[model samples]
Target: MAKRRALISVSDKTGIVDFARELAGLGVEIISTGGTASLLEREGIPVIGISDVTGFPEILDGRVKTLHPAVHSGLLAIRDNEEHRRTMEELGLGYIDFVIVNLYPFQQTIAKPDVGYEEAVENIDIGGPTMLRSAAKNHAFVTVVVDAADYAGVLQEIKEGGDTTLETRKRLAAKVFRHTAAYDALIGDYLSQQAGEQLPERFTVTYEKIQDLRYGENPHQRAAFYRKPLAGKGDLTTAEQLHGKELSYNNINDANAALAIVKEFDEPAVVAVKHMNPCGVGIGTTVAEAYRKAYESDPTSIFGGIVAANRTVDAETAGMLSELFLEIVLAPDFTPEALGILTRKKNIRLLKLGDWSRAAERKPEWLVTSVAGGMLVQESDVLSVEASELKVVTDRQPTEEELKQLLFGWKVVKHVKSNAIVLAKDNMTIGVGAGQMNRVGAARIAVEQAGDKARGAVLASDAFFPMGDTVELAAKAGITAIIQPGGSIRDEESIAAANANGIAMVFTGVRHFKH
Candidate 1:
């Protein structure tokens, strides 16, 4: 039998020297490219360069080296077919038994803040992907590896036997295609941004799996957490888990919701979320007071919920947080005393994140939703109404105190599911009704939850009131003012209802339907 041959070319040189040395010791002839060959020879491993194997010098600034038929036919030819073997013999091509290749760091290069188009374009790998595809196409006879993490396993498999199993080869081939697809997607996304195409003709994104969760929303379902490849510096997805058991799928979802709401406030703020809806939110002079007010908002509903705070958690706040049966607590930082207090809860997950300002500034380019057979894509809803942007449409104007509460309620309602109603007072959420079937039902739920606290509070709706009933209900609950998008045809009726009930109303002209 002819001696086995393996081709290795990679931009990431991790584990390459050791892998090449092991392959050489196993009697597999190593074929490599410029940097890879140099690194192997430096480590005392014999390597045949691409120029030596193909009998051609690398031209076009090293781009034309691996495009030769001698290299490709070795990777692509069928080993089991007599005609293919005869053609390889006629062409003086040797069989490639294994391929280890990784593409250029296009994603890493483009992620730099100062990268330009020319620099990014030059980093795109052409010959690397072509060789990977060719080798993967003949996985029946060739073992292809892309990830450095798999190097040890491939070496062990080769040492255990003369070749890798067909199952392992197929798995590695699949990984190669996935890796290449992600690489191309990053390039496409970067070029689209450069062209100022906010919505491209074809939308593509790539994510790396963070972990496989214990279960999904339900115990019977399976789930894994994945993060976008280009996610910015500080966000919930980038948060570091500091203590406790692994986060479940539901914990991450609820924690993300809480974090999003907490980021809306510039002051010390706390938000508690359950079932992907805000159950409590508060802003105060101090984080400890904020936690107290947020906890008092709806203490029953916040049980076992995720809590996110915009400020560093202190010992006082941690003591309060530990008293509850919370699932997770997230903050920008935690004092030593706070960490000591919270770590007593063995099952509660704690995450330390970056600055809230950075998290709030990030605006995703697209919002993607998957349905049964297809996906729905749209631009992300990133608009927020400033105080100056609010139009007072009622005879009575909101007081300065009412306006602050109205803005707070507006921010909270945007994160709630559709048919959402939030009643807030003194920058604290008194009541929130989320995911109701009707606007009036949601208003009623919030009013009932608030009880006497609903009196003198302000109401914010996610969308325009389709009817005047929600307005009338809020008025009866002692809601002093209302903020809504105000686009419904029955806007006049709602305005009339607010006027007759002596309630002030403002039009934001922007709807935030979270669902």
Candidate 2:
């Protein structure tokens, strides 16, 4: 029988020397290239260089080494075909039974803060990916390994038997294609950004799986958590879970919503989110007070919600949190006492997100959503209207206190699902109506939730009221002032309604529609 041959080439030399040595001991001829050959030779493992195999020296700074027919024909030729076997013997070409390769660190190089374009471009491996693709394409005969983590398993299988099984080869081939695809995607995305293309002609993103959840939003569904390659600081995807069981899909979703809302405030703030909608939001003198106010805003709705705080959690706040049946609690930091108190509830997931305050200033580059058969991509909704940008379109102007509450309500309403209405007083959201089908329906819900509190509070609508009915509802509920984006054609009718009911209304000239 002909001697089995294996080609090994890698930028990451982890476990390569030992793997090659084991293969050599098993009567397998080892062929390698460049740094891999040097490392193997130093470790007392005999290696046949690419130059020896192809009878041609590496040219173009080693870029043209593995592109030769000698290398690819060995990896791609069919073993079952008599003609191919005859041709291989005629050309003195040997069959490559295995190919172990890993691409250069292009993603890692580009991640550096001071990486130059030339350095990044040079790191994109051409020959390595070509060899891998060739080997993977013929995986019915050849075994290919891309990840260093698979080295031990491949060697173990080879030791147990003379060669790997077809099942193992097929699985390894699938991984190789996925690895190369991600490599190509990284290169394309980086170059597009370097060329100042905000929205690429083709939108492509790669993510690494963080964890597989027990189930999705429901038990019958499957779900996993994936994060972008270069996630920025203060991103929820990068948050550390300090204690408790693994996070469920719903917990992560609601925690993200709560975190986004809490990040909007610079002061000590707490936000409770249920089903991706803010059930309560409050800013207070201390983190404990903020949690108390937020919890009291709608205690029933916040029963099983996720809570996020912009400030570091103290013992007092943790004590208050322990009283509730919450899913998750996220904060920038937690005092030793706070952690001790919260950990008592073993099922509650505690996440300590360092420097979460910075999230308010960090804008995501893109927002992606999945639909029936495709994806929708757009710039993130990072725009927020300042207090100075508010236009008093009503006959009566909002009082200074009313303006403060209106701004607070505006911030909270932006995070609520549409059609959304938020009623706030003293920088605390007393009521929030989210995901209603109509503006009037949302307004009525908020008014009913606030009850007597709506009399002196301000109302913030995510979008303009379609008609005066919503304005009339708020007026009847005794809401003192109203703030909205105000782009509807019937803005005059709503303004007249506010004026007639002695309610001051301000138009922000900006809309925040969250679906």
The CA lDDT of each predicted structure is: 0.91, 0.91
Instruction: Identify the leading candidate in terms of TM-score.
Output: 1
RMSD of 1: 1.4
Off by over 4 Å in 2: 356-361
TM-score of 1: 0.97
Model 1, residue 420: what's the lDDT? 96
Instruction: Give lDDT tens digits, candidate 2, residues 219-257.
Output: 999999998888766778999899988999998888888
- 503 in model 1: Cα distance from truth in Å? 1.6
Per-residue lDDT of 301 in model 1: 92
lDDT of 1 by residue, 375-429 (tens): 8988766678899999999999999999999999999999999999999997789
TM-score of 2: 0.95
Worst 10 residues of 1 by lDDT: 356-365
* Residue 457, model 1, lDDT: 97
